[model samples]
Target chain A: MKQKVYLYRAFERFWHWSQALIIFFLALSGFEIHGSFSFLGYQSAVKYHNMAAYALVILIIFAIFWHLATGEWKQYVPTAKNIKAQINYYLLGIFKNAPHPTRKTVLSKLNPLQRLVYLGFKILIIPTMVLSGLLYMFYRYPQNGSIEGLNIESIKTIALFHTAGAFILVAFVIVHLYLITTGTTITSNLKAMVTGYEELEDTTKSQLESKNEVISAEVNNE
Target chain B: MKKIVISLVLIGLIIISIISFVSPKETKQSKLNELKAELSKKTTPSVDHSKFPILQKKIGSPQEVTEACISCHNGRAQEVMQSNHWNWEREEFIKGRGVVYLGKKNAINNFCIGVEGNELSCAKCHIGLGMTSSSTYSYTDSKNIDCLVCHDNTETYAKAPEKGGAPDQTLDFSFIAQHVGKPKRSNCGVCHFLGGGGNNVKHGDLETALFEPSKETDIHMASSGMNLGCTECHKTEKHLISGKMYSLSSMNRNRATCEECHTDNPHSETVLNQHTYKVACQTCHIPVYAKVNATKLDWDWSTAGKLKDGQPYEEDDKDGNHTYLSIKGNFKWGKNLKPDYIWFNGTASHYLLGDKVNDTTKALVINPLNGSYNDRNSKIIPVKIHRAKQPFDPVNRILIQPKLYAEKPGEGALWKDFNWQRASEVGMKEVNLPFSGKVSFIRTEMYWPINHMVSSKEKTVQCNECHSRDNSRLAGLKDFYMPARDFSPVIETAGTGIIFFAFAGVLIHGVIRIISTRKRKMKV
Candidate 1:
């Protein structure tokens, strides 16, 4: 038997979709600004990129607060449990229609490999992009009838790091689009994110129900 | 129902971000004023010339004013007499020619030719009185010296053109003599700003707008900042000015430089400081020149005699630049111009009067800056290039100084007779040079160093302006390779080849995996 369970919250779905839209716009406009393409024109691309970047910053701030308040940040923590099994499942077992190594629950949504990749983006790549972009924006400021801000020697390094981060995001998005189709069905993960509900196997459902009942019973006795 | 509220919040955040980006930019005038007050800490003059009793006497001529000035300040005229301002001559030791004499009076330029045949109009800029090409003015005489030209604090005193360096007779001499103080901007700019016959005609850097310039026009000489005067940098000792004109002298001992104040390492960044050794300070600092007025860049004497019904015809271009003039020539003027970049040390090689030049096909370099990229002491500098097609002596292979104007109508001037031979003959006779009598027009080029009208640092050149893919400013300049703009063909091919192989490998591996998975499912 299988049962439907609540997986994603309303704000979680909102933040995820909004952040994805912003990143997509930023990447397209950013590449145009780097002289990769010329569909939007250089000046317009720069303006759009700046606007999307600001919106992304706001979304990130809201998402960070929500994660901390709801204790959902724990889902991104890397663990050794079933790590090798998850890697092997994606590499070879997925093509043979084998079972997944780890099961998803409301409290723990991501597998070990997914946790490590998301954590890398959150801790390293995002910060690098934000820092370099801000440096480029405020490089020159009018002070005392003269421009005297940002005593940096050159903008070459900042440009290089920003470009590298953009390429990494491009690769990550391509792989992510393919992985979302590898659920119970091709549309399973997408439907769960949209409707805040997912179908869980009978064994996994019984295990979660027993864990909740024991915690509630303990709280009642205390 | 909860998703609707989340969507509204996201929309609200985007609206706020856009509003912040489009907010109005505020001007910081008060901050500039505070900075100006802080930088203006120089000491005032100690002596006041208004208390002198000899200046109270009546004066008719400029000599009378000079006599009254030297009555109080003894030996001042002797000091002024030793300066080039009084002699109008400079003697330099050239490599091929020993001890060559060169100065404004001795050199032949493209504009207005030289001071010969029409010295009265030219003497308006001269320091002494009653100077003519024929008459020998006494330089040692104290009465011949004009003190009011440099010491006039009153803006009223001015030397009228064709009056032979004499102040206008209408002004009160006693009041001007009493109000005498240190030279102001207007005093020095009276001649310097109006050189080469009119305002902003000769030098692309110096102009009348520099009288009280804004910070954007000139950071150092801005009225809102340090507010420097002409004498501040071109410091004078014993009445001898320190500045040297590149057209007049190639090298000099008294040349003032920006390193005198800003030092070698002015920028905080080590990379920018390293650039100072290879590039000139003005190359990056003074990005453009001639901001206030359009400067004349080219003149074609071949098109000079265009007439409309026996009257001189004149026409202006779409930009209001004088394109054709019967009195002068066809002129091309440019405003806010980008300078041509070149390598220059502290010296230049000049084509002096009567110097034999070859290569009539290309433009003759009247005076070329002496330096190259391979030289250690040379730095990349910006210069205003002035090109012209002027009359030259083909037989002698020398540039001719044609008398362009006359005080009276019958002086055999080029404008009067429309004859280059008569003007060249008269000019050569007056200057004591051999006349070939055979005249021809040749293309000539001159370089003027751009050092004034410096903008703030942020408005300077960007990297892509010089290091771009096509039509870059540094396109013809070899010796360095620019990244992002140029790539090595060998390295590029190797990198692309590796990427192609990696992509093919991934495609084959994924296809094999899919086929094997389908075959196993079919067997089961």
Candidate 2:
């Protein structure tokens, strides 16, 4: 039996979709600026890329506040438990019709592998991109009065870092899209992200009941 | 679900509003336009010189008129005497080559070689009245200054060709002297526009079209635009002009810059404003030079003296510009030309007359505008490069200063006798420089910075002209990194490879998963 459960919240779904759209736009415009291709023309590409960057920054600030306020940041705290099992399931078990080694619940939403990847995205890739991009935007040629303590002589290094980060982000989006299909059903993850609801196995109900009993015992003791 | 939809719509609306609010808008009014508008208001001169009593008498000569003018304006003649226009030279301290007096008197150009033996004919443009030869003319005589040449309001004042800088015999000196007020565009254009023996032959930006120019010819000098005179931007004080061409000047001082009128940060866009640090205003403003007239691009003196049936002849192109002359040589002219870009730091070094030719294998740079991307003062500027193949001394390793002009045919002038050996000997003897008795043609180049014929803002160089991958305006400048035009091959290749592989990997993975699932379903 399958039971429908509320998974992603409204704000979380909004942030996810907004970030996806922004990243895609940034990639398109950034690559155009890199002279890889011409789409919106060079000037327009630069203008739009700069605008989208600012939008991404604002979105990131709001997402950070939201994560901290709701304690959703803990969902991405990587753990060793069931990590190997999750890896094995992806590598071999999924092809042989084996059952998942981990179960999803309201409190712990991500599999261990997903936790590690999301944590990496938050701590490493996102910060690197943001810092390098800000430097690229604000860096003045030394002849034009320079920023204090940031005597950057050239934009070559900053541009390279930003371009490399863009490539990494594009690659991540590709893999993330493919992984979205590996859920309960081919479209289950996408549907949950969109509608904030997913159908899980009935075993989650027993787990919820046990948690409720523990909460009642604690209340009686108090 | 309705709440989610409402929230999403609200977020989208907020983002759209933010973008619309922060995006840059087209500025309707700019400070430069306001300044131009203010300047366009015409002002009549406070005193009309047509009623002056000192100019009523019949003037004997152009020099006599100068003497009469000095009787009232006492110190002005002394000021003119000290100017570069009067002495034809100035004291300049060149780098590596100590303090030297440099000017047209001793300077050599690819066109017409030098002014040593050709002073009589060349004096048609000289400010002074009597310059029979370099050795005999008295520069100290205050009477020699031609006051009406610059101060003449009557456009009829003209110096006859090869008349030792004397006014045309037919001109009424008394009428011109009475009408003298201030120099008009025609006075400067008379000599400057006709430099190098023809209209618009030397400096590509300066031409006869500038006298009553339309807006497309020049914004500043346009009759219908700002309508500025030569003295407006040149800013003369005590007869010493503030601007000096890098070809003639070796020092960085006394240069008129765009910053003098329009501040350095003149752009509405921050990115463009920042570009002022490395790019000159002329680089973008003067997109194409020689706008209305074609300027001489190449002169090959090696082909001179090639006559049909021993009679000197000339050939003109469809535009009436000279293509070949039996006396001068073959010529190439360019119209509406895009200028070459270079890094200039206001300082330049000239290959002066008698300066030994060090490299014969390459085209000699007559005047090198010194700068590099690493220099703090350097900025990229547009320049018109005039190339020529002129006579040189291969044995002495020096450029030959051949006599080009003479009053009569038998005077050893190359134009008269068509004999390079006698002309080179006489020219070298006049300048007190040794000649090898052997003349060879040498390829040489001269750089003339384009500072006029400024286009309107709408027609200025676009961003893609320099920032694009193909046919960039700055394609020749490779010292520094420019975005879109420059990138590391290693990083670009690696990044592209990673993205390509990731795309292929995902496609293959999706296909295999589909096939495997189908097989499992069939077995079940």
Candidate 3:
């Protein structure tokens, strides 16, 4: 039997969807500003990119506080116990219709591999983009307005880092999109995210049913 | 928890608003106090000239006035005669270029041509009296020196044009002579501000506004802050000014520079101090010039004779800048101009009267600021590049200074008759230079170094101004690589190649994993 359980909270859904929208908008505008086709024009694209970046920062700050208050940060605490199983499940086991090594619950929403990848994205890629973007925005400062002879290595470094981080994020998003489709049904996982409720197999209920039968048989023998 | 987050956000925004609004007002108040303190340090001239008996005498010619002045102040006229202001000559052996004899007298400029036959008009700027075309003036004569041009403190003394450098006849000469004292900013700017015929025409950095300037116009000469006079930086010896014009200077040593007062290591950071080796102080300090008035950017002499029904026509551009004028040819003027950057080692090479130019398609450089990025002594400096299209001899391939000003009409003056050939021949004859009689307008450029109208540190250009990728101000400078602005093709290729290989590896890995998974599933 399958039972529906509440998964993502209301604020969590809001943060996730808003962050996704802002990132998508930022990527579209940023590429346009980088002279890739230029649909919105360069000037308008730059303005939109800056506004989206600020929106993303504000969302990130709010999401951080929410995650801490709800203690949902523990979901991303990665462990190596089910790492091999999860990798095999995706590589070969999933093709043969094997069961998943790690079960989803309210306390443990993300699997080990998902936790590791998301943790890297959160701690490394996102921060790198934010910091490098800031440095690129204010590259000429800290010289006290005497910029004539100042050598600006910081600007070049920031540009390279920001570009590299964007590529990493793009690759992560591609893999994440593919992994989300690996659920029991294509629309099932996406529906769970929208409604904040997921239907998982009642494994504990089945175990208790078998134990109750043994206890009844023992009582008959007595 | 949500309320707490909202409250924190609101508080953070309030703090930002307060800082953005209130801090600037505090800084402005402090700046005002600093300026007031600076002004209190200066003192006006002490020696009153009104009580002197020698100055009270009635004067006939300017020479007589000079004679009476030199009787009391001995050797003063001799000192004035030795200066470049009086002699109009600069002789120095510059490096790379050989011994150069160049000055305003011989240096051919695009504006008004040379001063050979037009001495009566040009001598208005001269420090001597009665310097006409036919006048056999002796440099040794003290009576020929003009004393009132510099020492006048009454502010009423004015020079009459085409009067052999004499003062205006209506001016109270005795009163001006009585009030003679140390030169003010007005006295120095009377000729300099009005150089090349009108206000804000030549030397884009200087203008009449500098007489009672604000801190925004000039940091050093501001009435409130520093209150510096011309002599502060142009420190003179025996009435000979220390600074030389870029069109004439050839000497290689001891020119007035910001490093003389402000040490090379002015910045707090050591890295910034090290930059002084390759960058000039004025480049950052005076980010722009011609802040107070519009300066002449270019003059096209070929369009001088354009007329509407036999009357001289004048036109203005979309920006209200003077684009065409029949009396003074075509002109392009601009205010608050950005300076072109150059590497200069404090020396300039001028195109003397007979010097051959490279080509007519390109501008003949009246004077080029000499330096290279490879030169250790060179520093990046800012300059106002004034472009002009003036007459040059096609046969000789040299610039010809056609006499443009004439006392009367149709006397071989380019302005009067709009005849280039006649004016070129007559002007060349006066200077003893041969002319082939073939005159063609050629583009020419003069580089004027920016050294004034410095804004406060807060008003300077921001960092992205130069480091930007498109339409950057520093795009023309290619000697030194600017990060984020310039890129290496090899490095870019390698970086992109790495990313491509990484993406390919991920695709290959995913394909292999899927192939193995499919085979295992088939066996099961």
Candidate 4:
């Protein structure tokens, strides 16, 4: 049996949509600056890319604060449980109409594979992109009488790293979009993200609180 | 959700409104108004030379007029005598060769060779009179300095070609001396505009077009714009000009730069201002040279001896430019040409006479502008590279300085006899350098740094001109990484491959799931 339950909060839905829009705009403008194709023109592309970068940084800051305050960060913590089953389901069992390796609930929203992938993106890819992008924006060509140690002779390494990060992020977005269709219905995940409500497995308020408490206790033991 | 969406739309509208209101239109209007105010504030001369009593007397010869001028303005002649214009050479300290005197007298250019045995004809551009021969012309003589050439505002004083730099006998010296004032554009343009034996053949930036230029030709010298004179930027003090050409100069001293007047941080945008450290003002400002006239691009002396009906002849292109001359050579000209860019640090090295040509297979750089990306003082600058194929000694491996001009035939001038052997013998004897008695054509290049005919702000080079993937102006510059022009091939391939594979994987997986779901439904 299933019941209609609030899966995403208002702020979470807003953040998700805003990030999706910003990332798409960034990829379009970023590739233009990378000399892939000219759409907005080089000067306009640079200006808008920089503006979007600032917007993303602000959004990320708010998202981070919200996650920490709500204790929702624990959803992305990796665990070995159901990891093999999840991999097998995607590889072969999905064609056989097999059941999902794990169930989604308000207490723990992500599966083991999702947790690991999301954590890698949060800690590695996003941070690298942001840091390298900031360096690209702020780095100055050393003029006469400039400080010796502050001299950055070349931007080759920084640019290459930022470009590589962009490629990885683009690949992640492709897979993430595909994974959205693997829900109970083709549009279920999309509808949930938009309305903050989905038909999830039934769990009463008291049952969800107990499950959250048990997960917190387990985390403390580790 | 509705409130958030509405508020976001309102915020975007407000931001766009603010950006639209604060446009650059107002700034551009204010700048134009400021220029108008500056143009109206002209300096009124304190004294009129037309009323002077000394100029009322009869001026017989050009030297008599000069004497009368010296009598009133005492010690001014001494100042003009010490200038490079009067001497035609200066003491420059080359890097490897210390304390060498370099000038048109000693410097060997590919055009018309040199001025060793052809002083009579080459003296047409000289500032002094009586340069019949290089060996006989006295540099210490102060009387030879022609004061009226620079100060005559009458615009009628003309130098007779091949007459030892003398004034035309038809000119009224008395009227010119009476009307003398500050030098006009015509005074400097007379020789400089017609250098290398033709109009606009030498420096692409300087030509007759600058005399009364339109705004499109040169913003600074435009009659409708700033109307600035040559001395405005090439500031002169005691007759010693501050500007130095890399063709004759070797040291990084007394150079005229745009930064001298306009600050280094001239641009409103910090991103553009940062480019000042590595890019010169002229690199973006002067997009192309030879704005109104076609300048000489290539000259091949090997084809000079071609004659018709046993007589020297000349051929002209459709544009009235000289295409070939039996005395000179085959010529190629270009108009409104995009300048080549190179890293320059204000200093240059020249190929001095008697210097051995090490590489015979490649064109020799007559004046190699010195700098690199590693040099802190270096900046990318625009240049007009004039290439030529001139005569050289194959055995001695030295660029031969041929005597190109003679008043009559049988005088061992290439123009008169069209004999390379006789011309080379006389040229080598004049310069006192061994010529190996053998002459052959060798390719050579000369770099003329573009400095004038700067366009307005609207006509300046855009960012994509140097930042685009194809046909970038800075394509030759590979030392530093530019945003759109440079990328790592390996990283690009790898990144693209990953995206392709991920996209393919998702597409295949989606197709297989659909096929299996249909099969299960059919069985049920």
Candidate 5:
């Protein structure tokens, strides 16, 4: 059993859960706007999307401020410790109940591989969407003389970027949703997010002892 | 992280502001208006603008003077005002205020003395306002201008010029309608150039052959009085002025030129195949005199006192029985790549008032005319005997690309093999139009409806896997089927499947640990 302290603050939990909700709705409405579904028809989907975008921006601002004030931003600082080990365990070892190579602590809520994944989402996907969406929304009514440097007669490039970014964002959401279900207890991690508390072992010392004995007996039988 | 986010936001606002303020289009519209106002002020005269007296009854056409003669000579007062003929008519001034040549008639007025005087010649023509003959020309102030030239021909001042006279050196057909057909008649070449001989009429379609667009164009010099422009009626003929007579149609009045009234272009609006908008008429019609007569146009305006049209200054030359132009050329549209501006040349004379005479105050409409020129670059030269008699410009431009629409896809749908064709007509007999053809991609390829942009929220078109790709664990487009391209499958069988099973194992481990933790907490 591994032990872990109360690392995630109330604000952190709030930011995480709220961000997830916003992104989920954003993906839904965005696809709706892209003519993917009819849950909210084209017009309503666009309305909801625009509203969700505004709300996401507001939530991000608060989260940023909270992260800055609390110095809790260090949790997502990506490092390469046990990175290969983590990959291998996910690829093969986990089927035999192989233990995680990295442990969680109050100072570091995410493991080495988790840090890399979080960094990619923050650096690549989100910023791409923000820039592309803003360009698309306000690029209108351009007269020939107004922007001499720009070819206002054509908007193919901007549209292409906006559409491409949308596909990437959707792709990321699909993967994220799948991985969420793969958490510690199909419903347990989900419950923890809802209740803001996760029960766990105090240390991996007992877990390692039991596993070692089981391993030795299996080897002998083989 | 907090500082980084804030900075990014502020940077975006700054960038947007810079883009908004740097546009240049606002300056051009104002400049065009200013140029128009300046040109109008400089070129159009303010004198002789008097109120015309209204008469009660309409006068009947003279039985002796034919309708052909009536149209050719009608509005001579107005036409002369627009030509160089007015220059010769001006009363010579020895000094400042007093008018000389007051009672003296110039020998250039040949039309009144010629043999065709009553037979389609200027001598037999009705002199409208300023001349001395027409013994019954009861009007006074002989130099002012007469409306009776065409309106009241019986006044007697009109007549055709005689043989061996200076080319009736009088202004004729100075202004013409645009649509007049081929063998151009009076519309295009008459005032466009001063060709042909003294008493011999020039250009084929006589002045009476002109008609409006709404009317059918008469082909031969003898008109059927159809609605067609001078270009349509005259075609290639350089002379002839006797034919059927029709009342002139009123101008559209929305604008004086084709451009102002035709901002929405017909050629591009229909876009039958594919093409960009056509250029405005004036853009390529800039004035060049060589383009008028001789060719291989050259210029030395860089030097002073340079003679334009260097091939023997033809005017007032002793040996000039008129050199036969070796190169015969036809009139056609000139090609112009630049689609924006038109530079034109013209002059306005201050003197030559028609007739300061009897009840001539009927007001003429002051139409703001835009100078028109056919682009000659696209037209092939017509084979003809004389230099000026050949066709000079072409009317239609068909060398442009067509359009392809995504949604409506009337003609555009044909390219992508879209079958929006009328489904009911497949079994019908005698369907002249085939709803399908190679343009519809009927054969050669079977990938129909491949590039359709039906990204609309139709469940029939939307793929669930496409929308949900990002929601799960696929890093990129790791495994998905696209209908547009050839695809063998995303995940190969055997080894890859084994790896997927391993991923499933990790998920199961996580789930069991989470379950065990919850149970232990419950016991405690």
Candidate 6:
């Protein structure tokens, strides 16, 4: 019987959930800060938004360090093998209860599609929010200086980018919520994140084939 | 063969991915240090030019303040005290007809100075050099609100406002931050915290600072909280040891030219020249009055709203003299305006707008004066999508009449230094009705007088006429409404971020796959 291995470390789980919560608060409080919905009123919402942003930044710093030291960063590196198959399974095969073509193993857990998406989240979306947020926080009026050599009036662009990043986060969350449901038992995948234990299916014939191939290849070489 | 090729490609991809993932920063540590050094700029404390010993005193001490101030602006002094402004004393009334005594019953208005006697707290508003001194402040010096008193940052004055003018700059801004772009609304915010005072007073047409600028508003009500500067309009030279016209009068005393973009002839040269009012035309023409035509009706009414008493309104079918008073508020014009004529003439210039409403529909024309018009022939003004309206049309309320203002392109007499327009009544303190604290606005005509605009709330009311545009007051709130914006520059910043990572990831994966494939092929 195949059991879900101890793949994600304790810190990884902590970082994941904490990062998610912080991002969620950031988006919620950020939009409120924009006067989208007055949940905490304007001032309080601003306070929360700034706090969550700082918290998020701290998480990101820690995450960077963790990824570097553990070298688990390999998990997010995009791969082409079975990528099309993985995409196809998500689009068509999943509905038919087809098994994931790219299995989640201890060495290579994520499929190519996941690796690509994670890469995007790490590189693109994450940085967009971080940079835009920093720009928003540090944006200033020059009492005796020009704004970036370009004397163009208004910081509306900074505002627009910040808002756009917020919307992107919203979209990511919507899609993520949907994707989280498509796990093994809906409950099974969720339970893994919650309890760090996934009831993975038994190892299949491919492992046996690779094992035999490895033995025979060694014998043949001799 | 296919399996071997696939394995080789996958192995090669893994190797490159490993290396690329290991490094994200392309710049070396030394280069990063250099860049950091390039970005950091040094800052120094502001230099104070004032010689008044009080400038360096502890603020808010009664002995240092009240005693020192009254000596020069003495309550007991005669000739200097006669000027209504200097007579900071008043009596209050307990009740009935609100006895218009020499002063206020409450100390608030300095009724001794027309303040409501008990409300003496209001006396603290007029700030200046001797605020904290024990000896009487030297009143012989200009008593006008000193610009330096509030705008304390003298060291890097120019940097306070960015290129076009915005509040986006901070007091502690590095030189680099100012060079890039100014913040939109925070510049004037620190001192303009209206509610922070012991008494919460918000004196302005716009809502509280806590509220957002409504989306429905025209660019005229630009978000005041964003990129803000004190001197886009109000430039300063020295403290007003000699009384200086507040920036509001700067445009008139040394009239600031109208916006260059506003080149159309609202004021015909003949009428403009004939009407030798040195004040900005906006002052009297748009000044809030009981009625534009000297017609003071019993009730306050707008052309759009009902009577203040919650009574429904009915207007005469045609333009006629209101022989009798009605429930609707009177439509009083400024000093020489004719509301009756304006009401009748405005019928003709209805306009059409392209994209003011919903996605496909046109915008509806609303009253720009924020006043209700007398219904014509009982016909309601057409409020339709894409429909045009008053205020935008030159004919509606141009400066030609009342002839208070002028626009000289180059070197007209009025168009000179300190060309600030007057301040709105929002800045006025009703010490005793007509004779009030008209020290002019603290900032320039272009810059909003956020201080006065946020102060002087309650116990006194400034009709929109009082707060409306006037020669004394430039179309400050108007300019503040519509700031310019361009998005193209930042879009690339967003796009490049997304694509860079995606491409880098693909390149790493592809390179690793190819290398693996080549090694496997050679092994075979």
Estimate every model's Cα lDDT from 0 to 1. Answer: 0.75, 0.85, 0.74, 0.86, 0.34, 0.37
Better of 4 and 5 by lDDT: 4
- Winner by lDDT between candidate 6 and candidate 4: 4
Model 3, position B302: C-alpha lDDT score: 80
What's chain A's TM-score in each predicted model? 0.88, 0.89, 0.86, 0.93, 0.78, 0.84
Write down the lDDT that model 5 would get.
0.34
Error of 5 at B521 (Å): 21
Winning candidate number (DockQ): 4
DockQ order, best first, reads 4, 2, 1, 5, 3, 6
* TM-score against native, each model: 0.65, 0.92, 0.66, 0.93, 0.34, 0.38
Per-residue C-alpha lDDT of model 2 across residues B20-118, encoded as one tens digit per residue? 555443442456767777777877888766577777887778877898899988999889989988888889888988888998767889888778888
DockQ of each: 0.09, 0.43, 0.06, 0.57, 0.08, 0.02
**How well is each residue in A15-79 modelled by candidate 2, as lDDT tens digits?**
79988998999999888888778889877888778878877887788788788988788788677
Which residue pairs overlap in candidate 2's backbone? Answer: none
For model 4 the interface RMSD, in Å, equals: 3.4
What TM-score is obtained for chain B in each of the predicted models?
Answer: 0.86, 0.95, 0.86, 0.93, 0.22, 0.23
Model 1 clash pairs are none
Better of 2 and 3 by DockQ: 2
Q: Give fnat for candidates 1, 2 and onward, in order.
A: 0.12, 0.50, 0.01, 0.67, 0.00, 0.00
True contacts kept of 3: 0.01
For model 1, residues B11-58, the per-residue Cα lDDT tens digits are 778687667555432223344555457557777777666677777677
Which digits, one per residue and each the tens of the lDDT, describe model 5 over residues B312-395?
122221322222221111121211111122211121111111211122132211111122222211111111111111110011
Task: Give the per-residue lDDT digits (tens) of candidate 6, residues A153-191.
Answer: 434666676666666666666556656656676566667
TM-score of chain B of 1: 0.86
How far does residue B458 in candidate 4 sit from its true spot (Å)?
2.6
**Evaluation by DockQ, superior candidate among 1 and 2:** 2
* Clash pairs for candidate 3: none
